[model samples]
Target: MAPRQKTAGLLDAVGPAFSRLRRSVLLDVENPVPAKDLTRTLVLNIVEDGADGEVTVGVVAERLAVDPSVASRMVTDCIGAGYLVRAASQRDGRRTVLRLSPEGAATLERFRQHQRVAFEYITRDWPEQERLEFARLLLKYVDAIDALRAPA
Candidate 1:
């Protein structure tokens, strides 16, 4: 086979493998806290990143590429699960902010630790140079994709 064909085959094999790997790493049910609801968990995580210790449902919906109502439902589910809190903004009564509670923060931290351990295990044998190169390549691809998706 030509070198081009070999590279194409390798890329083809990588696509499904990456999908399965991503799903296993991100949506594993055997996790200590488990992923009972991925959409809710993801929204809660976004809230955790806010400087105000919370994020608005509208912003989350924009980030998630979903409707405001869908994001509100996810927030409601997270609230019911005790993973998040919904509060009216002190400065803007009309807007609602979602926050991760103490319990929620702890759970999120544990999940991060699990993910770190998983990545560490997976890359344990990887050479430093190779890993650095992989990171650069991945970032390049990500940037290219983002550029394409940017509004004209």
Candidate 2:
């Protein structure tokens, strides 16, 4: 096959692989927030960034590759659901910041636990070295994609 065709085939296969992975590891279980993947991801991002202070909706939108308006609506929904709080940025009082609520933190922790269990189960038969290499490669792939998306 030509190189382009081979690349296309690989990209096509990735979608189903990701869908299966998400169903198996990310979404099949019950969650306290009862949110869709995007919303859940938004909350998780907020929680992850909370320690550094507050994260902005614009930053979340950029990271998630969604429109700022969409990110803002998701943030609003999370705040309404008691998963996130909006506060003034300490560094820049004029800027709005997002912080995950306690409930959101707990929910994120549960999601992480589910991910860990799913990975453990899925990799049970794999050699530890292979598992580690798989993880390293997956992260490298993701980082490469992120780098491509970064502003030059």
Candidate 3:
């Protein structure tokens, strides 16, 4: 097969693989706190990125590649569910910043553990070095995609 065809096949496979993974591990998990898919995703992002400081809704939208209105609604729902908290940004009092609640952090950890176990099971037969290389390559691919989408 030509290189373009090989790339197309990989891209085709990625969509369904991601959907299956999300449904099996992330979206369908039973958690102590009930949350929609977007809410759960937002919590996880906040846990990973909000530790340094508060994360803004705009930032979440940008990271998720979603519309600002969509992100705003998800953030509001998360706050109502007690999974996230919004506070004034220290740097700019008028600006709002988001951080996960303790409950949100705990829930995110549980989800991470589930994902880790699932990945381990799926890659159990792969050699350790191959697994590490796969991870590195996946990160590189994602970064390349991000760079392509970024404004020049």
Candidate 4:
């Protein structure tokens, strides 16, 4: 195959592979979290990235490329599920800060553990060089996609 054809084929294969992997990792287990819950949790994680404490819902929404109302609703659902807490911001009384509850933290950790295990299993037979190369290429792909979505 020509280089462009090979690249297109890889992209096509990768997209479906990701969907399959996502479903297998997140939906195969008993009492699996629904897609919405998983998405909300991921948003929370993005908000908490490298942060010591409370983050505003707006920040989370921006990171997730979603509207604030959507973020607020997700936060409310998380709070109702005992996965998040919302409190009046000290710096801005008009705003609310969202933080993960203890249960939320534990649940997120469990999800990460499962994801790591799944990844390890998937790559168990791969050669070390191939694994490293895959990682580099995946990161490059992610960076390129993210850059394309960057605001003008």
Best by TM-score: 2
- Clashes per model (N, Cα, C within 3 A): 0, 0, 0, 0
Candidate 2, which segments miss by more than 4 Å at Cα?
1-12, 23-25, 29-38, 50-54, 146-152
lDDT of 4: 0.74
RMSD, one per candidate, in order: 4.0, 3.7, 3.8, 3.8
Sort every candidate by lDDT, greatest first: 1, 4, 2, 3
**For candidate 4, lDDT tens digit of each residue in 1-152?**
99999999997897799888766765655456667767767865865562335587777777777899997787778788888887777777887777778988887887777665665666779998997798789889988986896668
Model 2: lDDT to the true structure = 0.74
TM-score of each: 0.67, 0.71, 0.70, 0.69
lDDT of 3 at 9: 97
RMSD of 1: 4.0
lDDT (10s digit) by residue, model 3, range 25-71: 54444442344644565545654565358688887787788999987
- Model 4 regions lying over 4 Å from their true place: 12-20, 29-37, 50-54, 136-152
So what's the TM-score on candidate 2?
Answer: 0.71
Candidate 4 lands at a TM-score of: 0.69
Query: How many angstroms is residue 95 displaced in model 2 relative to the true structure, after the best TM-score fit?
Result: 1.4
Relative to the true structure, how large is the alpha-carbon lDDT of every model? 0.75, 0.74, 0.73, 0.74
